[model samples]
Target: MATVRRKCFISYHHADQDAVNQFVRDFDQAHNCFIARGLGEEMPGDVINSNNTDYVMAKIRERFLADSTVTIVLLGRCTWARRYVDWEIQSSLRRGQYSTPNGLLGIKLPSYSGSFPERFNQNLSSDFPRIDCYARHMSYPSSTSALVDAIEEAYQRRTTHQNLIVNPRARMSYNRQCQ
Candidate 1:
């Protein structure tokens, strides 16, 4: 059985770069399970410096998040506190005039613990009926199939349960204390 490949945009703290790189190498570069886009991939390392939030988000949506169908957040020890991660999540969930919202998925890195990103948390709900959730949070992928399944599930939710998405939270202006 062949695994399905989805276009995935990875969101992670720079602190978790090694882990994120390893993950991409294993699941994407090596196995070709999915198309990976993030820092040093499709996304640029530096964003425009400006006080205008709308401009920045528009640039991000146009350049990085436009083609992605799923946003894979790599949750490391302090990934939840990064402001950029919050914006990325916000951009991923926002429905643009041309693109629909990307499926949000949080993958706990091997070193993950402590708080989660507030914006990412907004879309992730453990309680079910499950109608109020737009994302899935889970531990690291055990195999290519597991990761693909999660991505596919999220991809389906873009159309199946998009109404459940909660993306109205104000964007975080600064990183919070991890503890």
Candidate 2:
């Protein structure tokens, strides 16, 4: 039997490029999934304008994730705090004009220390209750097969978990910086 290659969007903190690079390389070597698109250092803007923001986000949807079937989030130290990552995740979850909800997965980098961004904080209902816990994890580095399985699982979830919608509470904000 042949391994399935999913169209995967690589989401990561700009500060953690090397980790995601290695992940891409490994996935390619194994034919686990295709690196269909990526979210890198390009920020929305220094100033927040709704029109520009909407335009940029639309471009992201059309260019980056419009064809992807899954989004593999490489969770580095500051990934949880980055607004772009939140926006990417939010965008990935929509079943709208851009694209249907892509499968979602979160991986903890070697530097992970259990602190996650509010978006992944499964238990923040009082503040902004998230869908909670679908993020798979491993303490050490992840293997290609592991990620492939995760991608497929997330793909499967889009059908099973109709509850996975954009959480208004976890919305991204440019004014805030990670502490």
Candidate 3:
């Protein structure tokens, strides 16, 4: 049987670049169940200052998140508060014009215990079962098999839900999301 590697879009806060760097390093050392090379850790300086929200999103969808089947959000202190992260989350769920909606999961950063993104918490609230709920999350440095299962599970769950888009923690769009 041939082993398949899922393309994973890593959604994270810039502040947690070190952790993401380590995460990618560890991923490279694994049995190779994922492909995360489309997008780099940092956005180009010109793109950062472009201030073209629509263009940026289109580029992200077509270039980076394209062909990816799952998205893993590296949860940090303020992951939910980031505008780009929010956009990424939303775009990942919607199956954009040029991109498919990737399955979702959250990985709590190593050595850090923090709350999951607010959008993912709506299901827990007594708001009559939110239509858009968050994806299940776990801690980082998890076993390759476990992480693979999570991604596969998310993929299966999406098929069943057939359009489940969870709420995002921050506003959907902005002229400038993060600095």
Which one wins on TM-score? 1
Which lDDT value does model 2 have at 119? Answer: 59
Which is superior by TM-score, 1 or 2?
A: 1
- In model 2, which range of ten residues has the least summed lDDT? 40-49
Off by over 4 Å in 3: 42-49, 96-99, 111-113, 122-134, 167-179
Worst 10 residues of 1 by lDDT: 39-48
lDDT, model 3: 0.65
Model 1 C-alpha lDDT per residue in residues 78-179, reported as the tens digit of each score: 998888888889889887576689999899998898567888887877677754678888889988788888999999999887887788768888888875
Rank all candidate structures by their lDDT, best first, as comma-separated numbers.
Answer: 1, 3, 2
Deviation in angstroms for 116 in model 3?
Answer: 3.0
Instruction: Give candidates' CA RMSD values in order.
Output: 2.4, 5.2, 4.3
Error of 3 at 140 (Å): 1.7
Q: Where is model 1 more than 4 Å wrong at Cα?
A: 41-52, 126-132
Q: List the residue pairs that clash in candidate 2.
A: none
List pairs with backbone clashes in candidate 3: none
Which tens-of-lDDT digit does each residue in 127-165 have in candidate 3?
Answer: 555444436677775587787777777666555653556
Q: TM per model?
A: 0.88, 0.76, 0.76
